[model samples]
Target: MDCKVKLWEVYGDRRCLNTFIDHSKAVRDIYVNTAGTRFLSAAYDRCLKLWDTETEQGKPGFTNRKAPYCVGFNPGEDKQNLFVAGTSGRKIVQ
Candidate 1:
């Protein structure tokens, strides 16, 4: 329920592929990149994580004092360092 990410593939039938549990609080949002190889997840733990779709593992990405609500990766190829995350504190962290 909390601090978990479920991977599902809906090709012909519904099936859960895997689940990732690393955060200490509920995961708020998940954002897949354009490549579809990796994704970003925001959690109530006030942290952002980067997860590999293949490995099904998450690595600590970013963090702040306020709880993170949403996250998005930079679509531009050369702008990977410029990601954005919205927090409950009424501000967007870059």
Candidate 2:
């Protein structure tokens, strides 16, 4: 079987928010947190942006990193909501 998919993001007027990202490396995957408070986007750009769903802006929590192919929050942990990012050569950011 073969499958195809299209992705898009609409914000505010749905027309004013027209920002395109060239993930030439590849946007391998995407994941959103359970609380819906934050979302993590992974790309070949070798970087990850933690977005604030409520304000539609980047969160200041996690910063200073290189391009990441995958990212997610640590499951079954508390006190510190740390993110785990996957990069090339079997590297992980915690």
Candidate 3:
């Protein structure tokens, strides 16, 4: 894997819009917030990253002892800043 995250515009013309290359390993999962303004990614590099959709910029936000397998953001409007992740170690982190 090239270790890149690509964003696409699906409705109009259906084309790639941006590419984010921050994780050192293959991205395992991605979660986009409900408003579509931000996203989170989990990677084999044992880290979770947060990205700003508009700016096309991202960075590692949390590191796990085991590789992160999946990630998601809280759906509650009042808890949008919260998130959770599952790791290879069979543990969940919030």
The best candidate by lDDT is 3
Clashes of each: 0, 5, 0
By lDDT: ranked, best first? 3, 1, 2
How much is the lDDT of residue 66 in candidate 3? Answer: 96
State in Å the error of residue 72, model 1.
Answer: 0.3
User: Which of the two candidates, 2 or 3, achieves a greater TM-score against the reference?
Assistant: 3
Q: Runs in model 2 with CA error above 4 Å?
A: 1-26, 60-66, 77-80
Q: CA lDDT of 27 in candidate 3?
A: 90
User: lDDT value for candidate 3?
Assistant: 0.89
lDDT of 2 by residue, 8-32 (tens): 3566555433232433445555666
Q: Rate the local accuracy (lDDT) of all candidates.
A: 0.85, 0.57, 0.89
- Estimate the TM-score for candidate 2: 0.59
Candidate 1 local lDDT, 1-94, one digit each (tens): 5889888888967898888788889899998887777888898888899998978777766889999888998889777556788889989988
Q: Which ten residues in a row have the lowest lDDT in candidate 2?
A: 1-10
Models 1 onward score TM values of: 0.88, 0.59, 0.93
